[model samples]
Target: MSEKMKKIIKIAIIASLVSSAYSVRAQEDELSNDSHVTTSFVKRQVAQNMSIGRAVKSIVSNYPQEASAVVSTALDMYPDKYQEIIHAAISAQPMLTEDIVKIALEKNIASCANIVKTAINAEPSYVDFVVTAAANSTPEELNEIVRVAVITEPDSADFIVQSLAQQHPNKIVDILSSAIEAVPLVGEYVVETLLAIFPNDAESVVSTAVRESASERANVKRIIETAQNFGLDEESIYKYAKEGGATDEEITAALSEATEQR
Candidate 1:
């Protein structure tokens, strides 16, 4: 309550702030010189102000070279803020989207879909980069990643699916199925896209669609008809339709429609 005590408390607060500023400045200087200052600086920022996104953006924008380490440290400090951390990091250093995604996914692979979503949503122009980076980092979640990527940016479905298919040729069926299942309306375009990329894998693409329809989610009728229109033989179409559990009636209707189109 005394004026002297109040003045002394005010001085103490000012001193504390000045010391903090100098400490931060020292760390900032070290960050610019050495990439290793990422952890301490990130921890201090998050501790002082729980703004993970702003903290990440500040460090990355100022020290682009240390973007990877800064992002890795931020994610480790606030795993739940993966979305904010990723968005800010990529926004600050768009060129380092790959490294940012790799770091986030490496820290929380379970958030693979969400991490990819956030990165792509933050930098829509970097959709391809975001996807490939995520795929490369967590190929095990390729299907989920593809699904979320397509859902996030359906317009880029073809390119997104094609890129992943090329990266994991063995997962062609899974990739196509996931893409179509995500945006069924794009099924026709997706099938056409993959067929264009993997011309030799037309049979696989068509069959996967047919099988996907078995779940009653994908449209087997449209897929078969599309394959038939794509110049696939009726016998192969019929075989795959049967194998995919397409009811005889559905197969008949699909094939008949294709024949009518021809």
Candidate 2:
């Protein structure tokens, strides 16, 4: 071939190679975009089929805020599944238990009492978060929640009661009384913690403990002694104990013990 023809042929071959490379690059880019779209669509469909708990767990690591939004939406659509979803979500991401419970309480997605109870029951370790969340939105429900917590998770009762009593002192009597009434066995623990934490409220705490305890005689005697140790007057101790259902005889015996100790 002539030198000029050979040069033209070489140029044509180079152009063909460049065109092929560009076509391959364009095809790759298209495939990449298609893959992204397909992935997003698949996720959407999966979310719809699965429980909010499962869906949130799947996305919470990478998209916490998005997971939260998805959960909120799912709650709205399937209120019946609130408890189930809450358990699943919290189990999947224990770290988000507080956030999920707070949202549930603030939004009033389920019965405030039920939600708090369920959260505590589902994850007793998260009792503080559940109690705090309920206290924030529905303080009135705290009493019932405490009652349930004491019975359901007696081990956590001390912490729950102490936290609530410290945070809402005004509710101390109600909280202590409800807990003792629901789970009479917790009375001793409640009395011990309250006296230690709120010594100044000894009279009121002792009084409530006596009145609400199912084992009135034993609890009253214990309260009477604890009260006297706290420097409460025998007259006041007797009054509170008697009011709490200690018979006149029970009060006399308790006072006798106090006198002997003194």
Highest-scoring model, TM-score = 1
lDDT of 2 by residue, 1-262 (tens): 9999999999999999999999767634533452321334325634775654565555454344444554565566567778876776677667677778877776677777788777876788978777877786777687787877777778877887887888888889998988888877677677778888888887788778888874656776766676676676878877777767777887788778977987
Score candidate 2 by lDDT: 0.72
Estimated TM-score per prediction? Answer: 0.72, 0.70
Stretches of candidate 2 above 4 Å error? Answer: 1-50, 61-67, 214-216, 222-239, 251-262
**Ten residues in a row with the worst lDDT in model 2?**
34-43
Superposing all C-alpha atoms, what RMSD in Å does each candidate have to the true structure?
7.2, 10.0
Summing lDDT over every window of 10 consecutive residues in candidate 1, give the lowest-scoring window: 209-218
* Candidate that would win on lDDT: 1
